[model samples]
Target chain A: MERPARTESPTIGELGESRTLARILPRLASGDAALLGAGDDAAVVAAADGRYVVTTDLLVHGPDFRLAWSTPFELGWKAAATNLTDVAAMGARPTALVVAIAAPPTTPAAVLEGIADGLHEGLAALAPGAGVVGGDLSASTVLTIAVTAFGDLEGRAPVLRSGARVGDVLAHAGARGDAARGLALLFAEGTDAAGEPDPERAAEVRARHPELVAAQLAPHPPVAAGVAAARAGATSMLDVSDGLARDARRIAEASGVGLDFDGEALGADLRVAFAGAEDHGLLATFPPGVEPPAPFEVVGRIVPAPGEVLIDGRGIDAEGWDPYSGWDGRSG
Target chain B: MERPARTESPTIGELGESRTLARILPRLASGDAALLGAGDDAAVVAAADGRYVVTTDLLVHGPDFRLAWSTPFELGWKAAATNLTDVAAMGARPTALVVAIAAPPTTPAAVLEGIADGLHEGLAALAPGAGVVGGDLSASTVLTIAVTAFGDLEGRAPVLRSGARVGDVLAHAGARGDAARGLALLFAEGTDAAGEPDPERAAEVRARHPELVAAQLAPHPPVAAGVAAARAGATSMLDVSDGLARDARRIAEASGVGLDFDGEALGADLRVAFAGAEDHGLLATFPPGVEPPAPFEVVGRIVPAPGEVLIDGRGIDAEGWDPYSGWDGRSG
Candidate 1:
């Protein structure tokens, strides 16, 4: 598959990056709840009234990303964003983030600095610079990034993927399929006369749509939108890391209901976005009567069903990428 | 370094380990905060104030452990326990965990299952049956486990390593020096006169100091003790992932104070349990007038200094294990 055209490449100093984090953290630190901000064994987040939400995710270079296609900064941002969004989807406001990375000893310190820069940048946007609390670094054969996000629910009900009810309104926030389009562009540019990918496509995509390419490389998950969904009475919510139909099916399975899509409503938008994968938007379900906040778009509906996904009122052969399954360039 | 001897080399899943975790988690699912406990994209822990605590750690088999001496279950438990303790050390109550493991493909699934069992066993003691939420399994050259922990603070102040004062009393909870001792035993056995470990000495240690060996294989962090320290108004706190002197120096540096240890108080304990690695315990400090909590032994006092550590009345060596720093087995 061709990736959409675009790329974001930025670099920083490895030795200075850790020092920068130490320097910048205290300046960005605030709120009484964060007793310990950073530079500690573990950050202490306030959970007044007892209990907190936690989640973790891992990003492997060969499996989850490729440096040839994505920049170090983008990879760092995506790693943090994906895990941060998981905490957000739980209706918990993100409080802290811990990241661990393993890279080859020969990896440039500048690349690591770029990664740290991306992490800080992402944290600045989604968490107001207060979320990233701790991290670790090590040497390995390939790059591996792992992140854990912590959140607080503020005494409200935690909306869950299993809570969608029949007649619930399915909606989405943030960009839909820009990442997939970027990928498509990459493939198309490189494809041989037989319409198969060639080496040149990657370079073309990098030159073409850097922003969209960045979308594939590093997704800016709709963190605020998730909090908005919770405030708007969303019954169930999740981040769209995988493609729409596939992730929606997860909600259906968890809620013990079927989800029906108004393919007409999403067709043009999804098509334009080139929704193949990598756009980590927030997919949420609210009660039938409540309207989603300003940023959300109605994409589907929830219903009691036979437990399966449908596309344009019929089943589609594709869903999304599976890490364990064999790849043939058909899905993602 | 060499590992200790073993009479009965139990495989990964000889006992009913996988089913044990599967069976225990449901029983602890009654808490409302865990709206989406286990079996989901991420576990949802409802925070009272919309904040949570998070932390992560990665352990590579050759670098972090050796299967020659430790059991499969012990590796699993230690891997999860280390991360859980990181979260707990912040004075937060743990709620959920995610584990990712990369192992050789030829490795039996049963061993993987045993690892899960060990993880469950570790969590069971601290979390009262809270479940493993999410994980990734893959094939790699050596076994690598990444575990992340989440927690709830219940709105109380989080005890950080930076809060100690000159007038504070230093105390510790849980066993120390045991894991280091086990390491010593393992090395002695492995480097016996013949390239193999001495079976009789290994058996002697196992019978007389099982807890010490277990500490090396599967550390049991005193999670409740951390929470208790928080409630008791601990000024500073941290889990002893590194050696006591090394970790305490971090607190001293962060707190801008000197730390003085009572060599007499530690001499007996260190001599009995010291193995030189993997002692997972909580070292905390309290105000001068505060009464020490039960199960916590007073070991040192805080002094005025800029990031200095001392034993008895003199400055002692501050060297500890560094993953990237090559090992020479020379005493500080």
Candidate 2:
């Protein structure tokens, strides 16, 4: 079926803020985190262990995603997944989320409702008990989603990036070169004659490269593995947001140690696995004798030289991954 | 000294994301709330007694504020204040904030730094010990700020808008219709010939009405009054963001009661006091025999009628506020 023009659907402005909220709020109430959720001035969530981990992330139109290429469901799922990974990176269980979304008044109400459904489904899949506790909505020329996520430590100490020690086993999970590879394909074939991302072209690319496209649109990060790593006595950890080399460099600098990667362990596409961005993988270092839980593949070892990151005795380029030379899928 | 043109200053695009963040992050580290603050995947904050209240609010460029009228400092302060009020209304002591900011790449780095300074100062003055925990920066066409606040309930049950009882005393603190009145003044005399908000004209208006302009720009909402009201056993509470009549109607509907106002207690400008929005005031109801907090000025009483709101025995217009009739200071 052909998608109707934006004008065919009722705009948020025509329905007004109150009615729009009434339409969108119901779809977002997926399960409960604790004491309170939505329809109140503020939401009360369980901290569980006296401490809660907090993080915020923003997604803006153009720099973040193209509406023409990605549906509102994808955008919302990405937004929720983006923040949940941050919480998981802290070795905490995601407890709740509060989102602030701003869109043009002319936006279709269905778009917002679809986003809400995505948020609900994403949380249900990634962090079962976590829920959208509260949210704010407003109008802007550009569509934007700002999410603040909360997580509980469950009495475990937070794993900091500065805790990796010399001789620690460097490990990773849920990351490969796939997301960035998929992104490269999209840029190469997803645009129309005018070089603008077209829905049909994007669909064609997705059909041809299903895994790659899905990786970019919806890479399921190992959220629960974070707490497992913490339980397994992992020393340090972080979410591989930037390319491997760049993010690994962060652990090197923070831990005041060197990271020596084992080339054979880095997958078939070594450079892509090391340089691909937005994989949302868990990178950690465990004490030599502390065997990591399942799914954490050993990638390297921590070394004595402070702030040095090398793969098979050679330093990787500073701008590790160059999958899409012009657009890095971060800020424009 | 005159402010330099945006081009004269180093733009974020030129400075780069890392450099702009380095310039802004330092100003945001006002004080430590607990285990972690910024510079990590997520921040860990203390949620004493195992429960925390969360709320988020967004501020968009044209709908919420105009650059020509509000400096980056004022905008940031307003953003922080806006979310802080929501938390306070929950009868919680704000403990931390996580913000997501999006702006054009061409924006001056100084503007972001100033906003960071404002976020720090606003927190210091309004909710001490509440520091920015984590944040995200992205590029967008319209400048936007989204703030999510965390508050501790301090072992007290949360105050809800639906707890009002018949014959309860309706009291308010901080709100007085001044912000809307000042906004009306700005629209009337502070814009240039093009009807666009202009700096010099806004400055002139501010100079002429210092109190009114300050009310609009930096409303010192009695943040502590909320906790005090909660401690005093207030039955219901809310922050008056949408004017008295409308918000009272919300409380009335939620509590299944009516609100009857006392004109004499409403203040010198009764209509303005009742009709103004963005006052960020604490509006609460006390049980019939319970004494209210000191700062909570009695404004009216709760009655038996369901969802009816009146002032001096007459129903107020549904559009309680007419100040800046064309601009509601909400969504565009």
Candidate 3:
């Protein structure tokens, strides 16, 4: 039989963002015991014996990261940080990771080395010996890194976002706006009268609150806290990816409940963390009757009301950065 | 310190096949536990109590697949088949998969739906409800798919390619050479009676061997046989990816042993399936003392001799189809 003419060919950009996925999905068959695979925040691969954890995240350099702002090592660290936090959000002990990178043929050996260095530094800080496993290197114009992390459940049922209930006390275990602060600093430096980029200023921000700029560049998610929260009987959990306000909304919607934030609970300095977007900082909920685990700070409360998020008794838009949305304010 | 200008960049293909993985190792701090990560066919992910299996492969349109020869659904199946087989090679039951795709924006929703259908179809054959959990869609020139599959060990030790020992029985399950046959038909049609493009012949061939053509477009891997081999104590496990002769060479190199094949044992009617390629069959090695499981045909045996692969008692180059290598004899 003669093959049909190809009238559905899409343009390059269209091909990149949309058509390819549409073209490839029909071939997949159902899998065994995979509760949630593909099409969400992470892939949930089932582990027998009461442990179900997940690992995921993809970063495209030109689209996801930029050399104008981030070094290769920083990019590597962020790669590990984002995926590690996903496992952490499930309240699992992170154990291993696999990294696959696609880069231009012209990518420098040193840059690749820096990426590995950053991955090592970032992952080492959270889970020792949880190094990079399998990866692929292919030629492309821009850089793409896909990472899959693995974790141990330690005999606890995974704390899922859907488990939150009304009347749950919401608590957080890590600083929030540090990465955002560093980003603000970066924008401030970029727009300064000198109009020159400063490596020193960037380094200083990273040093003072290694948690801040590093949060932006390479967030070190509080992995221990996630496991602790699950053990402490936290009802629902999520790692902050988009933003506190945005991520909290996900849990709220998933649990069919409303979340109320107490402005007073977050110290003034910590409130600044909300201004920037980085990666997994814990936001967990426990039954209203229980006290939060050690070192956790009360940030909000889950309410019976469905589909609403309130801060200081006022509604806030669940807006965060959308890569496709244009930034009208940043142009010269 | 001022960062230096990037004047030196390595080619993607060069870095991909490079053997100097040690030189690429980065400095580390502590806490990461990525034991035995990159530099392997599949990275070992450490689970707390049970073992998990994994495999990954990337498909680039125009390089590994072509839109002219395949529909979107077929492309989807091929992508899934390639990676799923890798998990099967580990002798584990496939559980979930994650697919990352890059394409242009003008793609139709139906195409994506078709792709999803194909993915679901393949997954349904193995395990139901297994789907893509999370994936990122971005813009790129070519349609590229990066798929990662996860499997469960079911309390069995993973069968590695290195486990093949002297005096082991080499066996295979599933079809072989169908894809290669389809390609030959295509090639023959392209070069017709007058040594010119044979578009009509190509059409006729496509009609005659729909199965062979489909095999080339989307292969059906013997996922179950892999688990059966492991359960039956197969010493080494591997899926036939490149070609029988070439993949067998990898087993030999990894095991530091030699393999002897009997042409007669490969199946008297092997050519009836298809004469050339695209048969993603399964190959495994078991202890010499073990009996061949049902459905597994003993085609060869592992030998004490180290290095080199012999087919029908002769040393023949096992190199498969590589665009750069320019049409080796088998491609015709």
Candidate 4:
């Protein structure tokens, strides 16, 4: 069987599904949680806690990302990072991930390998012991990645968004709005004059604003904080994905309580901080006497005004980033 | 909030993410295994034996299915059915599913609702206690559904494809080649003059060959048979997602053994049975004196010929369907 040189890339069609899978599987390392990894009827993962938390998220070529602005590695990393945050929000430690990717036949098989590498490295960075257990690959015009993550609560109660109480102190544990700001920066300066994403300009922008762009691309969520918060007696917790203000409101609505945040504690410009999304961080509430876990800086206080999310006593609308509200309307 | 009547269909963009989710959530009923279902950051599912089985499969619009031939309900049903089979093949009882779907904004919200209903009903029909506890919705150029299923082993050792031993009695449960034949029927009789899928013609063909088309579109995999095979002391088991010959080769290669199938028991033409894919049946091998569980009919026996998959002593090439090998390059 003849094959391409190490430097050269071949389309998946050229390599065939078996060959393509052979090329990509090595890049994904199995985690300790995986009792049985890929290449079986199904993978078996350990959930010693007896209760496993599960969540899923999807990333599409047009609506979720632009290929010109994201390396295949970043795409995979972001997918893994986002799903891990969801698990973390449940006060669980990520145990395993099952990913499914769809791309065109014309795509280089190496692109998938890169994504696999990203998934591996992202897991290493955010949740060291977690790894890819199983995955599926298919041919599609739009590049897509769907990640489902499982987590172990270590026999602790899962922190629900509805657990907040009126006297609890609200704290946060990661980037406030860096991801959303980075995305704004990309749309502003990373695109071509025609408003389409341009690889060259995006690279230049990333070089200039590495922190923001990296936050938007391959974020390192405080994956360990969820378990820590839960151990330290967190009354309620959730991932601050759709901006602090917006996500806080979810806790407020769910708990039948309100939350007030100090503007200075948001760590960014007030407007950007309030409206920003994609900051995969932990927003948790702790009882008055119990201190929050490290890195969870006190940012707010739970209030009796039900369903209200306030900044310095002023109410704010929940303006989370929503992909289905018809933004670019780009199909392919 | 003003909304359209129940009979009027609206695009996802028109209804927005929140509203769209509100409409779809009611259709996806949670199961008993879910301690905490959707609306939380992640769902909590029971893993009573402390070990869980996981697997994911992606279904795209083109290579996997054609909307002209399959309804949205069928698409969701097949996706859930396939993943559930993977779990069942592990000798585990499926507990929960986390689904991620991506589609264009122009897609009707009802399509997703139909898919949700399909997922719920599919679980009810196959694994009654398993349900969709969590899911993600995203926009994409192509319609894609990724389902990740979790299952409980109930303290039983997982049935792996690599456990087959020589002298084992090979068996199978569920359809053999009806899916492939039905697909052939669709492409031949349900297509327009140019070979493009025609909804009307596909509908007419389905009406005439309901069983065959249903096997192809919304298959009824003998999911429970997997656990039965395991409890009955089967040496190995796997779900027949690919053709019997091809999937049997997986067991042969993994277990370092060979398989011999009786042609007459395949319930279809020899060629089609050996080459057919998407049957979602259980292929298992029991110890010499053990009878396979109910619904599992005797099909063949294991042989000592390493890496050989034979039909009555004649070797057959593994001819399973490969989506990445490029079938029809359709994007949308």
Candidate 5:
């Protein structure tokens, strides 16, 4: 979608932080969760259960994203989605977000406006009623977006990782390897900014692989499924940020149970399903005799002994996106 | 203070993010406010008032600080202190902090450990019983620390900037301009890592001007005074993060009242008091006949409109730290 033209808008450096915030703040749509929104030293968010489930994520320019691949809107959306997934993993409803942005002074004010619009867009599409309540802005050599999301559990006990037991069924909600596939495609086609790739060719690639690119750039995690799984008596749960195999191992170790995956149930290439990262899908386990929630597919079953993960009775490598490895995967 | 030797420690690249987080998490001390702490996807913090005051700040390596000057411990302390001050400004007690750190893989694991230690130290010293509940770790080319602090208002209405009325006395808690002075000293003495100043000389400067350096490195804002001012019926309150003149002007504009400062009452140089940044002191306004709260010294008074700030009957420039100005101040 093409954004409206914002011709002759002053750069952030020209307007200053306060004035830029004033312009951006009005563009953000605050919902019921915000008791008091931006303009205060700190925003007040309604904590319905007297407890707040909070998480934070930081995305840096070179390591986490490249401006050549992502628009400012996508960056804002991804940042919100990444942190909100953590809240969803805990079976909480996302309530509000606080963003801290550090960027070079030369950055245009239009980029900030795009970010604000994207934040509202993401909240409306993913977790309705959630909104940005407050933020901080500062100057830095490189662009960075740090977001913290707050959630309300509504008195439901948080689904913890260490709750799975023998005989519990392992299930997942949302896509698996699409993001990794998208990244692979991006790498296959050169990602260098200076390289000569005609705009028409780039557009053709994006149009041809819309789903793949969207998965990598703007993942739509099944946020409501967390609450549904919790309601259905999910024993354990977590977001699949660092691949299914690696993250499944986390639950196995935490719960002291072995997990046996049904290869056919995965419905994807083994390599892709096991090693894909940034899926943002919720992986959950339910007690015996309990049906898995809608949108949640049963992919594996908890077993006794070893306390490890296996697919089709074969052990698989749990290699996933490790920050130190420098492998390309979503950090935000 | 000299830190203990950490010879032969592995780098973050060697340990990876998960292992590094494991090494760092144990060092963070959780208080009663954290219902569920680290190890979870998201932490649960208690909200006594059914609402949470949230704020965030990001510190970048080159623009915000220099590793040559600030140890990882000091960086962590400053990050926490800066965010906590915003909570204090809202007349709320800080409950928990969520930190997101992005550093190059080549960074030392000991540096991460030092940051964790500093977070605990800052919380204990500034807002006792507050602790780090959860965080995200990512790889970045530049070192960055982003912290989001949550606070509890304890049923008291949040003191806002637009609440000052005519005849209100302006009061402040904590020092003025000391941080700016410290920055000046650092610049004057030279900040280049390659240019070595004698250890004796550096130590001599530090010892002779301990307060200034400490203010710049890790400001000890009188956090308790925020709640005190609120309890004493403060009409308006905010943290003096920018300059006294600039921040005062913010209150004046927001509340539609003029402020007149007593030069002698400032107890500091006019230039320093009005133009310095990052002091993190609490500035508040109280109605007539209300003795300003303890530890809060009366510095000025609210008067009929021009909606401006004046010192000793003379209008002053609202010159404060503007990140775009390229003046050194704590961006975090």
Candidate 6:
């Protein structure tokens, strides 16, 4: 795609907030769900079900992503995917997104445009018919993106974590450990201060493991499978954002049931599935004798014991990513 | 108010994300608007009007605020007020808020509790019955707060900026320049490396100018007046966030009519009224013969000429606060 003219593109400081917003507003795509779009103090979204399912997530520069490894487009796409998956976990159809971004004064206008492009593409591909309805921009030393997504359940009851009962089956959809492996690869192949790896080496890695790289940079959650599980009478459902075992413990504790994983049923490497976070796959529990929905693999079963997650009749450490404990020393 | 016990209080790093969330979740108050609150992947909020008004704002540590002048409680209050006012500008009743905060791991758990208290207090005092429904937390180099607010129109049509007629009267509610003046006073008082002003001097300033300090640290936007203006047949409306002159230009451009300020009717110092931003006061225009709503003062009139904002028959510069242009050198 031919890039917008960059010679005349001005920094946010040069054009100011209003003018910058004017430049970016036309690039956003608003769908039928938007009663009112950008350029207003507030955007209006149609709530067909008389209720809106809402979730928000924040992506800080150093902790969430390094500018060197990820482009502005990837950053935008990843941010949207993270929040939209949460809406999907509730068995809802995404309606709209509101993004709040803070960047340095020196940030290029082109970077903002790139981020918008990624947002537009992500919504079109991941949550069709949903768009960027509104946003706010401010100045900060490091770049940050805070996104809040809204969805409509279409009169269906929300699938809560506390609904799983003993004798239910646990299932999942989407890749398990690709994102973690991708991050490991990036760290092994050290980049420059700007986070850019050598072009030839980077291209080679991409060709060898394209899916892994994409998983880390631009995740594609199985959003449709959420509704499918709900239709299949899922008693409890959630997106696995912080590793399978750790997130499973959440459902187990909430539902007062133990999740016993069948090693053969998982069909993935235990090491990867237990430690990798940010896969954004759907994890759901369905009542006994109910066939799991298509694309969902039966990985485990709920037992009478509560608050325990076991694999092959043995308990393993459920520890996963903790933001504060995993402070990479880059942040203050 | 007695401060919470400090010695036993754990830092975010010590407690980790899940435990910290467990502590903070109970402190948040969710009103009837929230069908589902925290602990779930997503929150369900009532959108009784069949539509929802959504808006967001980002507040950075150094650019948007200073810890020297504002406590955690005040920061939370001001953040909620800023976004709630945007919902009010759409002539909607604020319903729920979702906050995303990013801070260093060393931040105290007590500070988080204080922020929650402030959010609860702000909602009860400003938009009664509204509450914080959900939120996200992350680790960052500096403290940042991003708030997204949702509101219900309650079957009333949204008052857009494009509706003002040639003979409409422009009115406003709440204090005009107090926040700006308060910010000026804080700048006058110097701070140390840790964003703390000298103890004795700070106490003296606080005692002498309590209202001014409060205005800057914890603004109380007149949220109720928005619904009243809509009921009184407001043609166009918005919140005065970027100074009276600058924000008026938005209404003038949108409505395609010039706004002529009535200097005598304003009943305030012209410079402060025209240049101060962050007042978060409601600015609405009503058709001729419509009595302005109670507590709304007639400050200007709509004229035949379009896209011009004049005061006392003279064009004045509408420059106001621009975050990108106001980097304070304290952030990373």
Cα TM-score of candidate 3: 0.73
Give a tens-digit lDDT track for model 2, residues B113-142: 878877888888999988888888888777
The alpha-carbon root-mean-square deviation between model 5 and the true structure, to one decimal in Å, is 2.8
Two-chain DockQ for each candidate model: 0.28, 0.56, 0.06, 0.82, 0.67, 0.82
True-vs-predicted CA distance for residue A135, candidate 2, Å: 0.1
State the TM-score, rounded to 2 decimals, of chain A in model 1. Answer: 0.82
Q: Chain B alone, model 2: TM-score?
A: 0.93
> lDDT tens string, model 1, B210-296?
887777877777877877888889998988866877777788888998888888888776533322446778889999988768677
Q: Write one digit per residue (lDDT tens) for candidate 5, span B228-253.
A: 89899999999998888888988888
In the range A1-332, model 3's lDDT, one tens digit per residue, is 11222444432232331223333233222134333333221133444553435455567654466565678778877887887777777777776665666554345444555676677777777766465545554444446777777776777766777788887898887757777776777657633366444556656655665555656776667877887898889998887766777777778787898888888787585346454466468889999778888667888888876767777766666655443231211212
Ordered by TM-score, highest first, the candidates read 4, 6, 5, 2, 1, 3
Stretches of candidate 3 above 4 Å error?
Answer: A1-50, A181-213, A266-276, A289-291, A323-332, B1-49, B126-142, B181-209, B264-279, B289-291, B320-332
Q: Write the per-residue lDDT of candidate 1 for residues A171-235, one digit (tens) a residue.
A: 88887788787776765664557654444666677777877776777777788777788989999
- What TM-score does the predicted chain A of each candidate obtain versus native chain A? 0.82, 0.93, 0.76, 0.95, 0.93, 0.93
Scoring the B chain of model 4 against the true B chain gives a TM-score of: 0.96
lDDT of 4 by residue, B1-332 (tens): 11222556899988888899999998877898989999989999988888889999889998899888888888888999999999999998898898888878889987888788888889999898788888888888778898998888889999999999999999988887899999999989999998888999999999999999999999999988877877888789999888888899999999999999887776455677678888888999999999788899898889998888988877877767788774769532
Candidate by candidate, in order, the iRMS in Å equals: 5.7, 4.0, 11.9, 0.9, 2.1, 1.0
Q: Write down the lDDT that model 1 would get.
A: 0.67
Candidate 2 ranges beyond 4 A from true positions: A1-8, A320-332, B1-8, B30-32, B320-332
- CA lDDT for candidate 4: 0.86
**Candidate 3 RMSD to the correct structure:** 14.1
Tens-digit lDDT track of model 6 for A1-332: 32433655678877777777777778788777999998889999999989999999999988888766677788888888888899989999888999989988888877787788778778888889999999999998888999999999999999999999999998988878888888777766635455555445555666788888889988998987887888889999999989998999999899998888888877666678778888999899999999988879899899877888989777766878998888754731
Q: Kindly report the docking quality category of candidate 1.
A: acceptable
TM-score for each model: 0.78, 0.94, 0.73, 0.96, 0.95, 0.95
* B1-332: candidate 6 lDDT, tens digit per residue: 32343656788989999888887788778876999998889999999978999999999888888665677788888988988999999999999999988988998887777777777788888999899899999998878899999898999999888898898988989877888887776666645456555445555667888887787778989898888998898999999888898888888899999888989887665678679888899889999989988789898889987888988767766677777775655552
In lDDT terms, how accurate is model 3?
0.62
